[model samples]
Every structure is written in C-alpha cells, then in structure tokens.
Target: MKFSLIFLLLALTSCSKKEAESERTAHSEPAWDASFFSPKTGEILSYRETIESISPQKNLPISPDQIRKRVLKRRQVYDGSELIEGKTLHRYSIYHDGSFTEGFLFHWVNGFLYVVGSFTEDQKITFANPPIPIAHLNMIAGTYWHWPPQAPAGSGSRHIGLEQITVPAGTFDAYKVSIRKNTQGKITLREYWFAPKIGIVKEQNRIYSSGHLRVINTIELSDRSTSDTSDTSEEAPSEST
Candidate 1:
C-alpha cells in the first residue's frame, strides 16, 4: 500500500512538472509583429524601409510622411523562365497613390502598365497593379511591413524572430529573403514562414514564396499609433459608390 501511494505521488509530481514546463514555454514565446500581412485580405506583403539617411547607430525617428516616401519596387531579370529565355528584364515601381511606372512594359505595351487591365484609384485598391485583394490590402500598410501581431493580452513584438508560428491548423515560418541579380537578371524572393499568424492563432500553409523557409525580418511597431488617420479609417464604415 505504501509503495503504491509513493508511486502515485511521483507520477503526479512528474505530470505537474511537465505541465509547468509547457506553460513556461508558451508564455515565453514572443508576440508577432503588426504589419506583416494585408489586414483587409490577409495576403503576405513585403516592403523596404528606406531612411532619408543613416544616423549612425541611433534608431532614427520615422514620421508618417517619411514612411510614405519609401514605396514597393521590384526588378526582375529572367535567365530562363517558361516566359522568357536568355535574359528578359522588367522593373516595376508602385506609388503610394496607387500609380505605377514600368519602363519596359510602357516602352513596349503602349498601354498602362497595370497588371490588371485598367483601374481608377479607389477601384485600384482591388485592382492594385499588383493584383492584391482588398482584404489583403487592408492588412498591409505602407509601413515597412512587419509580422502578425498578438492581441492586447499578448502585446509586444517578438525580437527573437519566429522560425515558425504554428497553431492547431496553421503554421508560418520563412527560410530566406534576398534580392538576386543573376545572368537571368534581378529577382527578389522572400522565403516566408509556413504558417503565419491569421485571424485567430491558427496554422496555415506557406501560400507565398519565401525561398522555401521562414525568412527573418526586422520587427516594427509596438502598438499602432492611435493618432494616425489610417487607424480611424479602419474603424469607419465602408461606403460603396
């Protein structure tokens, strides 16, 4: 009887210890960033944060206007894709105002360089020359984008960089992120996390290309600025014309 009682106590203690360890692990994991995806559509978005000039080692203060200046641009040189052989090159620049300039496409196509047929500014939100959906566009902001965020209770950015963020049904992690210009030309590929943060903490497939792994990206934004009009716009009711 004593032996059985002692064994029971040991088993209970071991289970308790294991449970405590798991809790600690979970609690210690860092929170995701704020600007990783398009809030509207939940699509992956990437952008570079360019400063007017480097201020040595100090963290430079970035104003909203400063953030708006740096836009999304892409350059591609094809060595051998099904679309082009040898070397076909393309350079794209997307303006914050939803305007774009494509030297090659404009030089040859004669039509507007929008990937989608043609669109007005407001209509372009969905037609986003890049073809990003409205919902995805909502998640993505002009801020040199970051990661998916945790709720208020889980507030704060995770600096360690999540190799992979996984929930019961989703997962997100990246392998690498770089801009390469080979004989084929310039190509920027961002290896993304398998399952990134979603509406609720969930697991997902790597829908976007991230060089086959979760790419490490610098985090920005602790709490979104309340004074920003963008935040207010998110709260405003949508009106259809």
Candidate 2:
C-alpha cells in the first residue's frame, strides 16, 4: 500500500567511518548519478503497480478473488527545490490514481530522501517532524548506509552489487540494495532496485512467520516518462524540520 513508496523515500545516512568506507569502495565503482532519484522541477514520473495478497491457511479454502492482483497507475511530479533550515530539499506532489496528496510530504536531505512529515486533507499539520531515511543517494555497488545513524548494531542495509533487472519499462542496469534480518521465528527481507535517471523501478518484500510463508508483495515500474532537465526552474516556499 502506502508503504511501498514511503519506504522508498526513506533509507541511508551513515556515520563518518562508514561513510569513509563508502567513499573508498565506491571510488572505483561505476559512478552513481543523483538524478537517478531526483529529477528537475516540473519533471514527472509515472508507474503502474500491482499488489497481491495471500492466505496461508493450508487447511482452509481460499477464494480466487483473495489472490487477485490489484493494479494501479500513480504519477508523481517534482514541484520545485527549496532550502529548509540551511539544507537543500526537493519538493514533490504525488497523485494517487489522479487525486492530490492525502496528507503526505516527501523531501530529500543532501540527496537522501525522507518522509519529513505530513498534513491533513485540510492542511492541518497532524504529524510534523519525523526524520527517517528510506533510501540512500549516489550509492555505488559496494556502499552501505542506514536510516538512523544511531541505530542499534546489526540493523542496516548493504549494497549487494549491481545487476540488470528487467521490468515493464525495459532492461536497466540498476543497483540492488538488500536488507535482511531474522527475529525469533519471523524472517523479514526486502530488496530495492534503482535504475539511473528512472528511479526506484522495482521492489520486493517477503515475510516468513515460523518458517511458513505469510505474505509476499512486489512492485514494478510498468511505464514512465522523463522530460528535459536543464530547463526546469521554480521557486519553492521555505519550510524546515
């Protein structure tokens, strides 16, 4: 649901030592462009998504409709670039189906994206100041980063090299970021793929409860459009976290 893109908006900011490792390791790797995730103002990107749910009750019968894929098309456009609290941020307007935001604000800090905050439909700031990294920026095939730099040990992400992942948009050389962990009897795994200049084109998630499959969700980029970047310009309002 909303978590698909919301998680994509949040991911990596490491401490100095880890950052030094990223710099050294990424120095020889293929250069990653910031435009892979951030487009110029007035730019728009579209995607067709399909979500499926599963029922793991082996003894019970499940209807065919319970496993049907729900397909949808979403459009997001970069409104402008703004400077908030001395940090440069990019502003975007996300359209669900064809409607405007229903209390969502996404921003990027130093190229890394964050949820930042959100508002009610009437513009009332219901929740205003949540800083979390769902994804890192300009990462190569060997970089490592985390959402909160102060997170507990062993909970972070690793760049698992680059590969050519195919989707509805076509074949793209994308960087794969993996997050994996097992707690008690539950296993949680997530993978994200980003193509240069096209953005996060695909994502997959799996949850295994007590060694049995609970659910699986996958999203792919079915279609997209990118306009010329050099001519984009717009002034944005000042807002800070």
Q: Per-residue alpha-carbon lDDT of model 2 for 1-241, expressed as tens digits?
A: 7887665555333355465444433222222345545466666666665566565653235566666566767666665544343334455566668887654455554556555755455544343443645555666566666635555545567788667777766666777888765666667688888655556668888877745665677777655544465233222212210
lDDT of 2: 0.59
Best by TM-score: 2
Clashing pairs in 2: 10-133, 10-134, 10-135, 11-133, 11-134, 11-135
Off by over 4 Å in 2: 1-38, 55-68, 101-138, 147-154, 181-187, 208-212, 226-241
What TM-score against the true fold does each predicted structure earn? 0.20, 0.60
lDDT of 2 at 25: 37
Alpha-carbon RMSD, each predicted model: 24.8, 15.2
- lDDT score, candidate 2, position 67: 65
Q: What stretches of model 1 exceed 4 Å from their correct place?
A: 1-120, 125-183, 199-241
lDDT for 230 in candidate 1 is 24
